[model samples]
Target: MLLLLIPGVGLAIAVGILFGWRWVFAPILGWAMLTWLLGSLRALGKDAKPPGAPADDVVATPVGTDQRTLFWCEECGTEVLLLVRGTNRAPSHCGQRMHERTEILN
Candidate 1:
């Protein structure tokens, strides 16, 4: 949002310079004043906590012994135990050889 305002102010200044009008400074000045006002308001509002939002709501669940699980890698057919802090959606290792079962020929 702040990045977009810079180009607008620059264009306004350039046009103002080209036209020899002092009004160009008005836009740039207005933008700066508005930016400062909005920024201060935003800062002031930051301390007002929203309802029903717990302070620790963003915390991640700790990986525990109960979370020990197994996953199979489709790419290499390898079965691996899920590690703590491991990827939750997929197998941990890449290019692992998956276990295969077959009947032996007599």
Candidate 2:
């Protein structure tokens, strides 16, 4: 993120210089370069982690009809079907009621 600021500040400084506001450009350019360097160093020091590591915080729930399931609108408590997985929580279609059902999986 800080790395991205460097070019922005540089551009601003260049523009300021062209517009005769050279004094303000120096500080902006300096800060931008400093932040960019720090960000680059931090990124370089970090190591990439492998996929599906134990430290990863993903909770996998089995998807099927076998287990006892409760489907409801998390927002309104309306009955609804667990149609798909969402990034945070399951979303309901309409009616504000959770549609819950149970069936045996083959």
Candidate 3:
């Protein structure tokens, strides 16, 4: 889709030069800018939330020695062993925060 912009710009330049219609570039450039802005917004939205994942506001507290806590990512089968962290925020993977799973080792 971005490759199409090159031809659009070239065509705009050609029209402006041949017919002295300089105003044609305005709409073309505006379209390009709008496309870029929308694309960036979509990227941010995707990075903000992954499918079937809860919000990031939930904080996980540290567990005892007998209990183990795992931060798991649903998007990609990734597991992280959270141990002795000062922060309450959960670990993140694949742009989203991992879900917490507690297990008893005893």
Candidate 4:
């Protein structure tokens, strides 16, 4: 991803050199509009969502009253101990659902 920024920075520099800071908004606006147009077109595509797209939105294992579990994020090691039961939805962290750990650690 960092490599992707090199071309963007080069373009910005070229635009700044040729048009000056006062005209920088023109290229920025054009780039934004182009990105938006491409995004809109992608949204209209027939295969915009492949077969497993719905699975991404599916919640993890359901939480229940008898389950004394800790919702743990493997990404950042963030833990949330379920104290009171509410919705069965498992807590999410770092853009992914946390795993359930039934064994309470000391």
TM-score of each: 0.32, 0.27, 0.41, 0.35
lDDT of 2 by residue, 25-95 (tens): 67768989999999998876664445775564454456654654457666665664444434333344563
- State the lDDT of candidate 1 residue by residue for 1-106, as single tens digits: 9999999778877887888656776676898999999999998787556888655323343554234445666776666543442222343357443432322223
- Model 3 pairs whose backbones collide: none
Off by over 4 Å in 4: 1-67, 104-106
**Cα distance off (Å), candidate 2, residue 96:** 45
- Name the best candidate (by lDDT): 3
Per residue, candidate 4 scores C-alpha lDDT tens digits across 1-106 of 9999999788778988997965677767898999999998886784345665543443344455354678899999999987754555677799887887886334
Candidate 3 vs. true structure, TM-score: 0.41
Better of 1 and 4 by lDDT: 4
The predicted structure with the larger TM-score, 3 or 4, is 3
Write down the lDDT that model 3 would get: 0.78
lDDT score for candidate 2 against the true structure = 0.61
**TM-score head-to-head 2 vs 4, winner:** 4
Q: Provide backbone clash counts, one per model.
A: 2, 9, 0, 0
Indicate which candidate wins on TM-score.
3
User: Model 2 Cα RMSD, Å?
Assistant: 12.0
Across residues 1-106, which tens digit of lDDT does each residue of candidate 3 receive? 8999999878878988888775796776898999999999998896465778765454454555678888899999899987655456677899888898888888
RMSD over all Cα atoms, model 3: 8.9
Worst-scoring 10-residue span by lDDT in model 2: 83-92
TM-score of 1: 0.32
Per-candidate Cα lDDT values, in order, are: 0.59, 0.61, 0.78, 0.73
